[model samples]
Target chain A: MADTATASATGGSEPAIGRGLKGLLLVALPVFLVGWLIIYPIIAAIVSTLFVEATDGVQFSTASYRFFFSDPYSRANLALTLWTTGVCAVLLLLVGLPIALYLRFSTSRFADLVQSLAIFPMFVPSIILSYALIRTIGPNGTVDILLNAVGLPKIPSPYLTPWGPVIGLVWDNLPLTVLMLTAGLAGISNSAVEAARDVGAGPIRVFWHIILPRMGNSILVTISFTVLGIFSSFTLPYVLGPASPEMMGPFMLRTFNDLYDPLNAKTQAVISFVFCLFFGIFYVWSIARNQRSQSR
Target chain B: MNRREFLAAGSAVAAASALPSLALADDKTIQVYSGSDNNIIDFWNNTIIPAFQKANPGMKVKLVDAGDDNGLRAIADRALAALKSKADPQADVFENFDARLPAGGVEAGLWVTFSAENVPSYGKINRAAIDMPQQLPYRGSQVLLAYDKTKLDPKDAPKTWEQLVAWVKKNPGQFIYNRPDKGGSGGNFVRRAIHEVNGRDPSKFTIANFSADYAEKSLTPAWAVLKDMAPFLYEKGAYTSGNTQSIQLLSQGVVTMVPVWSDQVLQAMSQGVLPETTGLVQLTDLALCGGFSRLTVFSNGANKDAALKLADFLLTSEMQSAVITQIGGFPGVTWDNVAADLREKYKDVVPNSIPTFPGGDWNAAINDGWYRNVATGLARG
Candidate 1:
């Protein structure tokens, strides 16, 4: 408080720097609480998952890692997570591209409304969306009601299956994906687009040759954000997901709490952190690298 | 005053308003911690608290449903830390038990012995209910077999472990139960099964030595049965959702029957987690394990005596029954058989009795048998 007061007395960029620090603290306070409650415990679980004994002060080993993924249940779960991510990402690109473009060119009020709706998922927290999806698709839930209306079999929720988590992941990541794509599309120079149209180029040709080339940097931004969102999401998948092929969050929990094995949990946490760290670094780096090269 | 100070002061005031007047009372409100559900907490608050408080007017039972067993365990850790500070703990009582009980909690003065004389209907509780200061619930949960009669039909279902395994072989994935290390309910099943199957003793926990590995090897028979039962699981040998899963599967018609909390089965029926055909069974040679989810009052509780009084009230007969009705809180203390009229609504659909876990074998079961076998060490296979 005294330092901030001193900075304000200086009444220049020093005050601005102090305000920035205050803003940083405002952000950091919640992050610390969230980290303690949701993040660190999860990290503890990962550490626990790496070692076999899970006993306190035990050294790290790959035994748990070997055992967990060696079995049919764990093995099947890994495949499920990978395949689901791949399929969902492709599906997102296909479905999200049109929505992104529609919002880019049209200046109509309806177009703006559509754009808002497209990105609404970003504002809607994943936890709320995940629950709503589960309730809707759960066995004997609303989906079944619709199925019955269409004279279909009473297909129960695949909630206990891997696909259940997939829907949650896509729903959570989609809004942000669309948001990034829209930003990229909107960033294309209007003058260049107008010149192309004035020179008798068709709209489709213009979009493919000029607008797309110009917006390459934005598209990369969308990919980077989407990948980051998918990699880091903990809640939507953990709750909606099945016990088999348990993700990093659930596995970490089992190690530290149920197993009472912190060493292994810490190892697991470190490994997960490493995985996310590398993936994020590569993603961000690629976006920056692309932006730099494109400026040429 | 500055806004943050004002808010912090307001917090203290709110805390003060919520505090019970303890100055003139021998017994006062006991603050409780649990991982149990809100519905369960509400059940304790409305039905259990009033009954105990009515008898001991000075007592008001305050339950803070922290989360689940995990949340309760964390609260226990915090209280233990506060005990070190030689100060009053934020939490008065917490509910949980695991490998940490003997080594971590009980030995740590996080627990003190609870008595029946101080508790209402303590004498009526079976000897098996008092195994350790830790396992005994002020309220006990019974580990009994719940079978879906529609699946087994006219054959009168399995009456013994041998019969049950045979049934599982005939109808794969028709029967299921939880793994022990996952939670206490399953751990109870493992212990009960060991006592019934191999005649192990709970009081004799030591095996040539106190090494956990020794305990692990001692559980061969129980694991052998589980190994055979494994192939017949609902997911065909996948890890189950523990006790709760079996009840849900019974409701979904996925598995015919499995072991679960007797109260959970009843709650399942109430919540529609179990189908009507599903009912509980206590075998003639039946063995069942029981554990307490007690209101464990920490020594450094803010109001220690008041907490003790609240704990005492919760253990009373009237409060136990109230816990039974709403929280489906199982009664550790013996009560008059619930009204025959009430039984008729759930009796045939539920078990006639909670299978008694062998009193003679808890030590062997928990240490080498249940703990070693299912929890820490899997059978060599």
Candidate 2:
């Protein structure tokens, strides 16, 4: 492995100009594809929202944006979305980081079982997960029946509340966070950990100084992804969240489909994309930093 | 050649290449886009379309079901988008429930207008159904009370709006209707309550021109009554989100009663999702809101004449009766024309006429208002 790495390193030192042109050639196709597929639709959506159609003709107008911002429900929905996404991302870090750490360091059979369990949700579609959560936690559902069987009072199902999405989002985001963290931990050197332990540093101290610094980019990626996923999510929050303080996903859908307000829906979608960029910037920054480090 | 001549040559080549496919598409085949239930689609494809094709030799009809994911609303959204862009729509006929597509298609000039002169079946259709502009009524559905008979005796069931309130008060958590924005049955239930609470007259709410001021003034009593009734709903102040959800609750005995579409309940009963003892009630005091799903011919379509012929064929007695027997829907034509057995079965619950769904803007306002004033008001109170 060392010989192969050395050979590749030596080979990689070829003249910068040729390598740079080759690199650009390889990336050009992907950049063009991304621009066409992702950037074009985004530009179209923004442009569509900027124009207003009247009896005479289409003209430049902020009518859609004004309509969306003017509605109290839209403002409430935005806040609720931020709250749900923020809380879920934080909770996932608190819960998932420890699990990832344990899975990374331990080799026990229980750790292997835990690893399998953590990734089990990756196979389950969000819609199926939503329904499963409903059937398990809904009124007169499995949990209710179990509680009744044990002669216990049935607590109202949380599946219809804000906690519902929190639970679902945490579960949904777990696999990806764990996978990223585990991969990140693999890159972390064992010599540093051993040295820290040899020097009599405690577990928390080692984690704080040695592990946390190494996992910075991974942590950012996980948190940013979790926030983005929850913010733009539709099926889970729509099925789980309360109707009045709806998240932007279901709210925008209802506005466009049921209320027949396409313009407002498009405006709301643009607003959501703008909000996502707040977290999305971290992802962009992480990628740029990684690219810069690699180039160096 | 110059750049202009070269570009013209390229354009000519592209157009020539596209000629065969375009010709194939305009080969007199009528395309119908429907988001109707599977059973209705089966009846149309198996019985109606084949018969219509045979009657009109050298003509073809194609039925496109939107499947489970893309429903009537999705189809309407796509069609409307195409119409707004002034492009030819893919389908000739657009069929779906009134609430899902609404009569707004007619008002927007998206549908072809029909009268007795153009459509012979119009003479057989009920006069009340005929006057709906640009709408061709093909099947009827009414919002009705569906109850588990094992839990409540049919004789003891609520027969009027007042009786329903009293019964609900007596037995709380035993009934539920979906949120109005979520399902047509629930929306109609709210609309009916609004009409019944103030007065028994349907005329009061059936204004030709919708006035928001008049609605606010007249519907004050309705809001009060709905607010009062909300607490007694199943799961205390909580409610289901859709017609299927409420029906599932009923089937599970989670709730003994729910407001559901009559035809939907029938279909569910046949499928065993609902028990044998389930029964339906149409209140006498407040008329159950009822309307027919329309088979609309798109104004900008490839085959207009064939589409019109297919629409006419759908309204005939044979197809209308098939709608009842196969799909559990009321006939679009005069009630007397329906099969005797099916008519007798649905006699008690059959509505006298199709109720008008308020104009699109009015509907949007009312649905939003109810969500704010009634649905949330109950929760807070």
Candidate 3:
């Protein structure tokens, strides 16, 4: 591998300019399309929020952003989005890591079943998941019926509450989290685990020292992905969340569509994008570090 | 050729290329854009379109289903753009067009103003139903309080806004409404609350009367009333997301009462989704807010004549009666003009007066204010 790497490095250096041009030509269409479709719209939305219509003409103004920061309702929505994202990220890791670890270490036939179950949520569309969740846990729904059969006191439903989206998003995001963590766990050689065990390390110590340290990149990637997904999520939150102090997804939608206030909606979008940029930076940095370590 | 001559020649070619399709579009084809529910869409596609086609042999009406409010707004924006450029708007008639939209389209003469000279059926239209001259009021649906008869006695049903509030407070966790932004039923309910607190005068709130300062002052009392009643709501201040969910909660026996649309409740009963014991009543002191769905014709449409003919056809007694029986809506024309038997059948449901809440800025303010003041009673830390 080292010899081949060195040989490729020398060869790449010799025809560097020509190969670079060829690679640029190969990526030109995708780069242009992405610039036109995604980057241009994002830039345009951010720019439009900065310009406000005045009596004379359009002028630069941060009044919309000012309102977003100062208005208690808008601030509450932003705080709720951040809170939901953080809680879902923690919950996804809590629920997903154990299944991933079990799937990685177990050699039984049930391991395949567990792996399939862990990944099943990816196949279920969010709209159907929302409906099924409502039927299962909504007021006087299936859970209520079952609880009533056992003569237990009625439980307050999580539907239409802040926890609604948290439950849904964690379930909807479990498959991707488990997949990523399992792939990270696969990188830990069995010999290293055996060595830890040979040195009188318990299961918890082995996980804490060997497995956890090795899977740090995966955990970071998982959290970032989960955070980004939960932060901008619309359907689950719209269907399941409270009417006010809603997450930014439904807040932006209601502002634009229901209130017919596009300026405030764009301001909200820019704010959400700014918040998501932190997780995006984390994701990009983790991937870059992984690439650097692999090359080393 | 010089630069100017070459550009002129290029324009000529482009115009020549577009001429055939423009001519084809003008061949007695009127494009009708509708952004209503499935039942209304079905009424247009199955009942109205075929009837209109049969009545007018040569002329044709193409129904375009604008899927939702956003889609409808896109069509309106396209019309505004056409008005600016003085070009043929692809859409001729916009069914269920809120006249306050396109932000001064009415003032700009984007839509054709109707009169008895243009549309003869305009003479038969109920004068009380007309909100503006620019729109043709075709059908209407009012918000009504729907209660389960099994739970509440009919004699004890609240008849006025005062009694209704007392009843909600008396029966905690028995009443619910949807989020105002999500459905017209809840919006009208909130509007009624605004009226109730503001001396039950609907005239004080007009299309042009909404200001942030006025809203803050007037809505403060309404918010207090709503907040006071919030704990008495089903699930203890938890509101349903939309009209359908409100009715669903009532049907599931989770709540005993909810505000719902008259047409929707009738349809739900016909479909047996709601049991027969479900009863509907409007407040006596002041009826809940009701609105007539209006249609506007673009002045720049290619088939303006055909579109006007279609608009006139909608107000005819035959079509108006069909709107009553088929879609469970109040007719655009007066009751005397409708079929007598059908009029007699729907007498109980007919609203004596339809108090309309203004749509433009007032709508946005009330819905957003409700979310902030009323729906957020249990805001999380």
Candidate 4:
């Protein structure tokens, strides 16, 4: 690995104009596409959100913000979305960590199968899952049938309530989280583990101190992606939520598209976009900060 | 070649190009704006458009699926705004609901004054329906109360508005309808709530303050009926996805009773969305029929002749029957063909009553500015 690295280092030193152009092409192409398509859309949505107004003709008003904050029901929905996402993230991290560790350390085929199942939900469309879950737990559905067989109370439709969407989001996100977390654990240098064993440290202590720290980048990556996946989502909340859970994304779409009220929808969309913007900036700062350390 | 020969060649080229344009000027295509769904558009393509095509081979007809009621309104708004700014109107045909035509179309001058000159068949449509606000050209169908025959015992079936309410209270969440703000049926339900509530004549409803909100306050009896019946709605007062979802729930036995417009159920049966066992039922005393509206030729279009011919063909007897038998929707234009024979053959598959407006145009659930205010109220609630 060191010799190939040296050869590449030497290769790069050669004064080839085409190689410099190739390097420029490689970096610039991806940057251009990502900026123009993805970043521009995000920026456009944020800008459009600011244009919404109240009937009094108070242009550039914060009436929507006041309305959202004043409504206890809407507040509860926001709190519910946040709480559900946080809980689901923690549960996924806890449950996924051990499975990831086992897959890294164990030779059992069953553990391998568990790894596949853990990641399977990512491939299945979320709407199909919501439909299946609804049918399973909806009144007079399979869950009710089984419960009646055992003399148990029947589960209601939209069984998760404020957290129904969270459950769906977590299920969708777990596969990617497990795959990433497992890869991080598996990438642990064998020499480091052996060195710890040679010293006075035990297996659990060595893992907590070394393996987990080495995995911090992966952990942060998981958190960033899971936050993104759960936030700004609409379909799950739209389908699985109670009659009106009022998630930022779904609420905006319903207001704009269904109700034909672009003003309120744009306002809500803008609020949600601002949150996304802050989160995105934090991610960029983290990546840039890490790059500086690597450069040093 | 000589300069004269070259000049002659150029002249011939220009004439060849100019010939097609002149032919196209006389034989033009009328662009009709429709807020109806693509399925209904497909019904026109398969049934009505062909009938029009057969009659006026000299002209062409174009239908733009404007998407929804607001979509139609927005299209009209754009055209009117353009016209005010001295730009050409894009669509030759203006088709939309009764509520919007008068509010936006006629008031804005995006439409021509209704005269016997363009549409001769205007006389054939029930004069009362023609006098309706913007619904002058056509009368589309809206749903009345309907139920599953297999679930409803014939003797036990609801016959009157009061009896229906009483029966609904006995079975609550099993009753379902689309949200009014969501679809046309929702508006129908809001209007019907008036009849069920106050014993006041529907004619009094055309006056100011007779909005559906009035139905809420004045029609305490109807609300009382609904309050008792609410408990029995599908999934114990849960909403279906929308109209389509409500019907799906009913067909699935997730709900037993739902209100689907006259055409919605028939269209569903055609599309196989619902089973054959489902049947149509309207409350006695012709529960508030929020009739569907249709398209008329715009005065500002490039192809007026072609458009008028197309409009005429669509209203003909052949086209109206084709709409009834093949794709289910209430006929906007009258047809001699849609008489007793077809009704007897199809039985209750079609509505026993094709609701018409004798008491002026069937009053919409709410007029323009009034509806916008009430909508905010519904949302706030």
Candidate 5:
């Protein structure tokens, strides 16, 4: 019985590639496509940045990378991208976690409504969200008018400020964050919480001891995905953020289009890729670890 | 199905889907890709193409709406690639082509040069309007200071760059321009500011005369001037994103004045998006940068002859007059060359001279520098 269970769990006791020719043929097209479409362009871009055309001939140079690191404006843009990504990730977790927790524990019909509401942002396009944000919180917009009606002091708007992109990104990222966290919460059985509480552990103790650790992988996955999404976001940042000290997405675009400097644009892109590599590594490691533990 | 039968079906489907487009690519068909607005697109599809086709039967004109600057740039890049590979460029005539695009294509001979011998109407084009031999100038519009006449008296309107600055400062938070990179109205305004800081001489900057060092030295003072004036701008240095937004601000009574394109403002007023009380004025010291929209024939286009015929047809007296009446643009041909009635009708609005800012590197430098020095330097309210 144990042998049969293990055999079925490990795919009918066969070596992974035992199907050989048929399996290879099935995977060939997709593998070729990924290599051609994704890996090849990334490699080409990185290689292009390494080589520079000098007066004498095409020579190896790190001038583009050096310029990106040394330039103050470029550094500021990179710093802004990192800062915004960090802030949005934190905000997403803070806003998404409680709702997810409530949905997981609650039996009320309102929980269904709450879950749907939490995931509603997924349907809203970023451009439409940007426009809607501007209308709600922009200068002389709905918020301002309401505040004026109540005779409150006028507040400064976030539009065209660094906060603009942050607000939009957090709102845009909330749905995915909630979905991931909710799925993680769903895995912790109610009996686990009941078991902890019956041992005289309070609600806080039950949550801290019985719930948080189990959802650790989901939280990490959420942070990784959120950071990646916010880092490379273009439309929200372009429409909402300040002209200077912009995110890398807009910076690379302006460099390529407005400034008409393709080499610097490629250099900017490579730097962005390098920055995102850390999160990419974390995400892959987390997934692999999860798979290993699941198999065990 | 068996693998062989499925493969045959897939191949047949692919060929069937491709057949129509292959049939459409014939010798008699010429594709004219235009990046102009819907009004201009309508002018081409409804007016120009029909008229041209009527005159030359059996010659089909396919109008491809290239959408915007980026779209046109993509098409230009395709042409450049085709030039390198020695293939047909698929596109023939490019309307509203910025000749400086695709970096070095002009120098690489990607477009056909025009002269009276090739395009008969070329001789009648205004010498001042013609910027290059490769471009055929067809229509134009200039940037002007557009104000709400109902609010600000016309007599108090700014007629020079210095006065414009003074006026903006006098009425704080009542004037705005867009980010220079986002729109040409604001770009021309910034160009005029550059000219103003450099002793009002528009001659110093040229298409080829751009270097990082030169830009740093020449643009520092202009940056200082713009930065100094930013606090008085709408919402204390908040700039709108585009030309339409600037006009929208003016219409909303949020701003009293903005730099706007002549054609756009007129159209907006006619459409009632802008009030009828909106007024336009050109600076007397130096007119804000205005440019002619030029069409170019691709050197490697398969339908070069048909394209050239269309280009010549665009400059005819009837078409030039229609350009004024239909699109609210100044005629590309000289006043004397156009119909007498149009010359009389538009005499009041004819510019003394349209000071054009060079595009290639100068344009990119000014836009980038404006963001770095001017927009970024605004003090938060």
Candidate 6:
């Protein structure tokens, strides 16, 4: 603080080169750190795959990337990741939005309890949650026993199926979604809500007009997080989903480990990273746009 | 102190502090990269390394956990990376499954070969485990049919792959196997099916140079069998992703029977993840694939001699017996050398020794082929 204050006070007195050098020094360390940790690894992985020599020669080739894109198996894994991400994102919003609204508006003890419940999932480890889901919904599990006691026929375990993963993913992601939405809702001025209410708007009308539009940025963030989380997550899908159409995380893992193909795995990882970057751009844009709007 | 004096004094302290560690790191630590869990590593640290360290003074063995089951792939990746970079490999000793190591690590020329004459414990190792030329054996594992004894009568259990298929057809949704590409137990089952279809010829699959055309042709019968058995599997033939998943199902009594590794089943049973009534059977007419977890000395490692000695120590009857007793895997040494209790425990469960894994590119190709051909419906299902 003292150094910053002294620098600011003497800003005009200092030469332009000195100030410029200080500014560069301030930013250089952070830039280098980010470059070394994030940018360097990603570029190295891409470059390695791109320049990977074929068994015959030392010539650079995109054969690995071509193989990744051309293979039906790789295509299927990408498709599965996208499908699970989209479905889970939509489901999270549908389930989390209403709960967020209730927690935002309601003053009852039940709402407080619900808020605590929403935060509870964030505390549980994903692996433990996966096992819990298996024990709860797997065949002859607690759910099955309860259903049987109620005279309902026992259903097959969903452990190795898509629905199994969808259910587990939603359960895992709900708390985060609700928390983000509630934070967004909390940001909305009470006066705006009250003014709409004073104009004789019903609860639903006030929410539809005032609250929903205000939370657009939050919704976008929530969706972005949901998509990225579901897209890259290894444990939930690995433990719950079937073997064939695995998410990219497990798919890349098997390609590298089970198949012992590092080149192809690197290619797949680069491709998945590219896929995530598309969503990542939108997230960055949303944050920047949100910050701009707030400044205004 | 002034800035100059303070900086100089601090640098001196840091350099002095780092010197001992640097000295210790120089040609002293033998890094053993393995794919076992912390528990297994703990077993090594507590039981094996101390004795080995005492035997060979001025040697330190560091256990680096690569990851589980699939960690051999990481070791291979590291070896490839080291070769590409022209650096000494970080790991001096690598402990991994025989099937997991690609052709003795000989394909990459990354391994130091061990002769029985040099390794005294090699004479005591089981012949089945001695198949790999460059590897020193530690413990062996076979794929076994793990079943809920409460649900399956011991006498009524299927004794062959054909009978197993018949039983699955008879009682639909009560049997399953994991995806061949995901786990070794599942891969073994698929390989066995292919073997049976090719007139029980193991040689066709073990070719060093994997011919895609031959694999496609020879695997036709196996694919057909899988297609037939698919509809009768748990959840209408949706196989679990891994052996653990199938084991979980068997434990929950979700499925009556599933192919599981003997070591995994034993561990699960002792941990109470499997019920007391859970039974293991090595089929009478069919041989499940079995192989040893091996240790190979890296040729480009810093401590090759110490690594070789460590590998040799691992193959001794005492260590092999300890492996069986502690980890619940078969002893790499002859069964006669194993403790009587350990032998009796696994006598009914151990499968006949089979030398069938096509260790080179054939393994990956066959696994991929199975996924593409037989497991096509599973993704959609």
TM, every model: 0.72, 0.84, 0.90, 0.72, 0.91, 0.86
Give the DockQ ranking, best first.
Answer: 6, 3, 5, 2, 1, 4
Q: After superposition, how far is residue A154 of candidate 5 from its true place, in Å?
A: 4.4
Tens-digit lDDT string for candidate 5 (A14-54):
76677686688889999999999988988999888898788
User: Given candidate 4, what's the lDDT at residue B326?
Assistant: 65
Q: How well is each residue in A1-296 modelled by candidate 1, as lDDT tens digits? A: 99778767887645468889978978997999999997887666665655446467667777766665565544443445445556667767777778888888777889878877777777887777765775577555677778989999977465545667677777767787787787778777888889999999997999899978877676666665665556445676565655445556655665565556665556655655665566568678868787788798
- The docking category that best describes candidate 2 is acceptable
Residue pairs in candidate 3 whose N, alpha carbon or C atoms collide under 3 angstroms: none
State the lDDT of candidate 5 residue by residue for B339-377, as single tens digits: 888788776566757888777778778878888777775
Model 2, span B289-364: residue lDDT tens: 8767777777777687788888888887778888777777777789887678877876776766656455456677
lDDT of 2 by residue, A48-143 (tens): 999777788989999878877787667877877888888888888888889989998998899989999999999999988987887787767888
How close is candidate 2 at the interface, in terms of C-alpha RMSD after superposing the true interface residues? 3.4
Candidate 5 vs candidate 6: the TM-score winner is 5
What DockQ would candidate 3 receive versus the native complex?
0.49
TM-score, cand. 1 vs. native? 0.72
List model 6 lDDT by residue over A111-196, tens digit each: 98999998898889989988888889987889899999999998866777877788889998999999999998999999999999
DockQ values of all predictions: 0.16, 0.27, 0.49, 0.10, 0.38, 0.58
Task: Name model 4 segments beyond 4 Å from true.
Answer: A1-61, A73-155, A159-212, A254-263, B1-27, B32-35, B62-90, B94-108, B127-139, B204-229, B270-273, B285-288, B296-298, B334-337, B343-381
After aligning candidate 2 to the native by TM-score, how far in Å is the CA of A105 from where it should be? 2.9
On DockQ, the candidate that comes out on top is 6
Q: Go through the candidates in order and give each one's C-alpha lDDT.
A: 0.62, 0.79, 0.88, 0.63, 0.86, 0.80
Counted clashes in each candidate structure: 29, 0, 0, 11, 0, 0
Residues B348-376, candidate 4: write the lDDT tens digits: 44444443322222232232221222211
| Ordered list by lDDT, greatest first | 3, 5, 6, 2, 4, 1
